[model samples]
Target: MAPPLLIFLIMIHGVCSQKENVIYSPSHICALKDSSVIMNCTYTYPTGHQITKVFWTKGPVKGVEPPDLSEDPEYSQRLQYLGDKQQNCTIRLSHVTLKDSHEYYFRFITDKPDVKWTGIPGVTLNVTDLQVESPERVTEGDSVRLTCKSSCTLTDRATFIWYRNSQPLTERRDRNNELLLQSVRREDAGRYSCAVHGHNHISPAVQLNVTYSPRNVSVLITGSGEIVSGDSVTLICSSDSNPPALNFSWFKGGTFVGSGRIYSISKISSDDSGEYKCRSINEHGEKYSDAVTLNIMYPPRNVSVSIIRSCQIWAGGSVTLICSSDSNPPALNFSWFKENESSAVGSGQSFSALQSGRFYCQAHNQHGSQRSDAVTVTVKGHLVILYISIGVVCGAAVIFMMLVWRIRRMKKRNDTHESQMVDSRPPHDRHKACDVELSDPVYENVTADQLDDCKSELDSSVYENLPHNNKRL
Candidate 1:
């Protein structure tokens, strides 16, 4: 047996030697995938022992020498050593992936036989991937929350940033892993992603869909709202909403007129003139546009003239005439014109006629003018009885004259016939008259003279049967 002092000194040397083989390193580390990672380490050994080989190995077992990471096909290309064999055992790994997650050990071999050291409980590397977590859909105006998630806890303190549609949301930087939106609007909806402030690793984007009702509902007229009759008009209903509104209803005043996004009026008339509006509807909700007026204009029509006082005149008197028409924007101007005259006889809706003539009325408006058929008006004196008396007298006088002339003509014709008969009485009748006169010769002197007297009397009687005027000729 050795002395106590020697025994104590030998025990002390063994303790010191055992303590010198220790390796120092972090117990745990978290790193991003597809990125570089560094494992910091240091080691101590006995002063006389010189290291012959230094390398890294993973998942080492007791009583067995593990193969170097550089020798492994999976890690050979990415594993690198950055420290000397004396103390530093730092290593760098390039293009790390989640499959590389494992506990690594730093191993060194001394020049002496059966002399080696391996770090126990070495750095535990955690390879993690980032992902964005969000709800699939949300209604507009509702609060929303999105999170930047990871498969493992990050070793570094991170500041979360958000992105929408590949564009960074500059004001959405948050210390927490979550992004909060109060009363989210439609503009806030898009594909979202997150990242640490200083790291290039960004989470995969998540789509955030937002549903909303119609807004800013309005009707657009293709042209001027004011139109003429028989013209076409178009109105389009427009609104802002998600899943655009497909159903639309049109209204004229309080009545439902049509259905569609576009309301069309072909050959529009005055009856179509009114306040119109449109209702836009969808699965979400509906909205109504403010009313708009569609004005339809037309020319004057159905113009007419009426004699308010007298339609016909018998004597000299004035008559009142009224003009009227049916038209949009009622005819404001009126004119009365006499037939066969180029100028207007009067101007107004009413006219007084003082002369005998046919008159017409014309109604005028901005659109057009129309004329009414002429009406007859007369002015005459009241001398009808006196004129009738004079005509009767003249007619009687003419009848009397014609009767007298007819009588004279008949008397003259009778006389001519009697004279002709006497001549045709033959010579015998005439000789007998002469013989009678001769045989009565004894009475002759007186008789022959008396015959001459009688003959003269007969001639005078014929003249008397003729008209006095004929006797004068």
Candidate 2:
């Protein structure tokens, strides 16, 4: 009984000494997703006990069998046993996933199964991912900043690497954790991410948007060259920008006319002929396109004919008729036509009449033509015969007047002084042609042939509004 008691005392002393020797530091640990981590583990045994094998397990070896972490298929490629017989049981895990979040222990076998030991309250690993923090949207020409963050501090000495659209960005001035972008452009908009220099963990990509004002603005027309009046016309304004332009305005002759990217002028007229442009605007700024000139085509308008004669409209006498019109091309041609005639009588800006007829003129351009109102011309034939006829009529009227005057004088002589008319007349009536002796206007010695000249002068002035003088032959 005394020998047994001494052996029990030795065993008790050995158990207490070994308990103080075994060690596993930092009994708790957390790691980032897909990141490598170091598990600080160590163990010390009595000098006499030889350690033949060392392995790590999920937990304490309760009954018998325990597997090694390095041999497991799930951890074979990623687990590294960086420990040795010197009592260092440290381990390195690469590309750790969430499945690795289990309590772990260290075991030792010195040619005895019972010598195995494990540390309780193992590291608690939480697989968290890195996140990229930045502004979701920014205007062009503005500065931007980006950051890489994790749920917990991975390491104070962690160096960061940035990526744009899955391509490595190596033009960094400083090897810091933040990325600075100055005066960002539209081409700089894309997905961005960051990661530690050598760590497998990377932040999730974040999309970046760059808003910019309109650029490369221009105006487009559906057709080129002359646009005829009363024809449909279309004008379009277009531009490129990061954020699409929301407002479009159209201007003509420096005056606001309409709104929209498309400006349509239906049944275009001559008034629409002018300089036109468009303006594109967005949240950032606005841009204007170069002015474009619009040309409207039209036919001759406000057409009329001029009779350039100061005398009467006569067949024997030469008279000139002029055609005038308003047109864009200045009326390419002019034509003279007689009244009630389908075909033109003459072609040119002016025409001379040698016969009695009704005439009109037309001015023509590329688009169309216009005709003026008609004017009539009359002429006297056989001048000597016209003069003889006028003389006979005047002689008869004069004889009749002489006879009546003789009869009236005889009657007055036969009457006494009291019976006489007394020549009593209103003073106003005495001025009449019949009361006083007057010249006979009917026989002015102007024949019909001469009257033709006077009639022509009147016709020229009255119908054509032509300039003329009242000259009589």
Candidate 3:
């Protein structure tokens, strides 16, 4: 037992005389305000003594006998020791502040009253309250810089890490503390933060606002393609930007029409047809939208009523009155009007001419209506024409009668000439010629009394020339 004690004593004495090595990665840390932090530490001691206690010390009253974090008023509920006395000594502090920034050391005690050690050159905690230093507003295409700041100067050199919208950004190693934006745009806007490289605890995110001019501007219109005169319409202006647009303006062709994000026309007209655009303005800059076209339709114009073929119409005769007009929707409804009449005389594209005088027409549609200029419609007289027509017909009848008489006389003369030619021809020899007569049987039909009267007029030479059988009769 005495030899064992001696050996133990020698080992203890050797371990006590040797210095312990303290290992703590990232000697310097940049922590954000009101964020959780971890101080990681581990140590080695000679192989003989039982460890009793381990604790941390930092901040305002740091050098003398320091207070235990477990008992401190500010850190009692928000601090946790995650390590044991053997070799590991790490702690977690929640909701850290600028006051937490200081030099920190880890000290350990053993069973022997005299065997106590504190690791010098311990982990250096640099609680840097990161702040984004940048201009409040900036215009698009403008160059800008954002700086990351710390509450206290750190003894150890550190590399800065930048985050946007809680996500880490890619940048060259040379740009560690500041972020340079060559041309600020609407996409380059979000919350920003900074932290030290190789440190898990980051600074409280400070918002980085990149102001920019309006872009991708356009005008939104709501109206029908058949937007007629007197119809209502609305126009909206839109743009992409950082922050809100300050003002809006509207233009029609070269004329300044109105202002505001929404432009309204209570009653549109034909004059409203033109090229239109919108202008957007902000603290950053101004931008214009692409041009759009606005068209206002109307019912009809230049309506008129005219007589088909001729303006003159005979009494008791018929004529067509045609209505015409120029209209956008092609004048679906038409009406004919007479002078000095309130109501329409007829309702159609054409009307039959009755008692004609002065007439007009109206063309109408859903949009509006138009009336035509009056035109005179006169009824022609037909008394002289009727008389001339009767006289001409009588003359033609007389001429036709005379032509008939002449034709009859010519036919009679031809018959008489044929008869004379037969009688005057030299008689053929009696022996060779046979007599032939073609006539009505007047003698045969006569009674005795008629025969006696006709007997005196009869020619006896006709009987004398008869054949021998009738010679004496």
Candidate 4:
């Protein structure tokens, strides 16, 4: 309802006073690390006002002149102005880092004194680096997931690539940021990292630990193949596990013998010869190793000769004697010998004694040899009986001759004594005493010479008395 002239005047005044001094563009930007970003902007001002200075400043404070980004040491080399000072205020920030993230404002100064302007609610830049999030530990055979994280969502559509132990996983690529592992195994444990495809930035690595039970358990013997008795031996238990097995148990056959990573037998004996195994244990589980035989070589022992008695085995004046011994890798070679002979008379485990004598057997093995105690073998035959009879007759004859010689020597000594005494009444007395002495025998100690002379006389008398064919006996 106002007048036309007043309305025209108000319109002219409004048109003259109206000034659009503002910036138009996106107010927020999300950028990748070490990459370039563009800030599209435009500005306006009242007519007849020329821009004297134009620059970009970050984190502007109220009533304070914001520091120009182009002059800043951190951004000077990377900042570039791409638009004119009048309208376009676009800018490019190259090689942006996390430290470059801040609110930025486009500022301009007019030629007139006290005339300056700054865009309010300016562009907010957010620079982000990749990071990986994973579990600290995972049991084997369990599914696992890892995520690639950033402070802000990336502006570009990205495909994630995974890596383990610094090696790229060529088969694992997905549009999502998560890496899924199905029924994970121990081999999958390592330093894990993630990256966006077509981007140079990669996340820092994180360690992934996988736990499992023992596997490939085995026992190793530290020595040569020839394990002789009295030699020291060691058995080592080894296995593969997520965490190294700290407990180990040793078994001899089915009996538990010891517990340790290394089992040592000092001065091992024959009793130690058997199958040995080891068990490797950890928190996860345990596993047993394959059994290994400890063949302890030793010398022959407990050697003995036994006479085999059998009704049908006795043959032709000979008896079978068997030699037995105890040894590892049983003694195969045996030698038979007489009691007093230095050389072996026969060879083998058994021996036949044709003649009566004391016999023994020697058992031989790689380690050493041993001989058995001597055993007496007696043979019964016609020749043996005849020899026994001869021996008896000869022994009796020698004793009878010795008695007669002693009696005669005593009679001679009595005769000499009677002759030496002057026989006055002595002859009749001596003759009477001699007859009494002959009836009762006188005893005395005989010298070696006397015994020798008696033996000589007895031999002659026995030979003459025996039959001519048996004289040699």
Question: Of the candidates shown, which would achieve the greatest TM-score relative to the real structure?
Answer: 4
Alpha-carbon deviation at 344 in model 3, angstroms? 6.4
lDDT of 4 by residue, 1-473 (tens): 66778756644322212363455466778888987889988877768988888999988777888889899998899999998977899999998999988888888888986677777667889999999999989999999999999999887788999999989999999899999998999999999999889878889999999999999999999977799999999999999997889999999988999999999999999999999999999999999999999989999999999996554233355678999999988999999999888998899998888778999999999999999999998877865566678789999999978976876687578557755653655546754543443234242333334233234334455435434423332
TM-score, structure 1 vs. true: 0.60
Q: Which tens-of-lDDT digit does each residue in 1-473 have in candidate 1?
A: 76778756644332224445534455688888777888887777878988899999999876877999999999999999998978788999988888999989888898986777677657789988789888888888899888888887888776777889989999888888998888988998899988877777777889998889998899998886458889999999999888789999999998999999999999998889899999998788999999989878888888988886653343325678899998888898999899989999899999988877899999998888999999997656453445567779999999967866765565466457646765877866765544453344332222222244235434455435544443443
Q: What order do candidates take by TM-score, descending? A: 4, 1, 2, 3
**Every candidate's lDDT:** 0.79, 0.73, 0.71, 0.82
Question: How many Å off is the CA of 72 in candidate 2?
Answer: 4.9
The reply for model 1, stretches above 4 Å from the true place, is 1-24, 33-36, 49-82, 92-124, 164-172, 224-226, 306-356, 361-370, 378-473
In terms of TM-score, which candidate is stronger, 2 or 4? 4
lDDT per residue (tens digit) for residues 346-409 in model 3: 8878887666588888889877899888888755556347656878999999996785576556
Looking at model 4, the pairs that clash are none
lDDT of 4 at 263: 97
**Residue range with the least summed lDDT across 10 consecutive positions in model 2:** 464-473
lDDT, ranked from best to worst: 4, 1, 2, 3
Top-lDDT candidate index: 4
Candidate 3 residue 69 C-alpha distance from true site, Å? 3.6
Residue range 332-432, candidate 2, lDDT tens digits = 69888889889988999888876779998888888998888888765445544556777889999899678657655653553343133324665445334
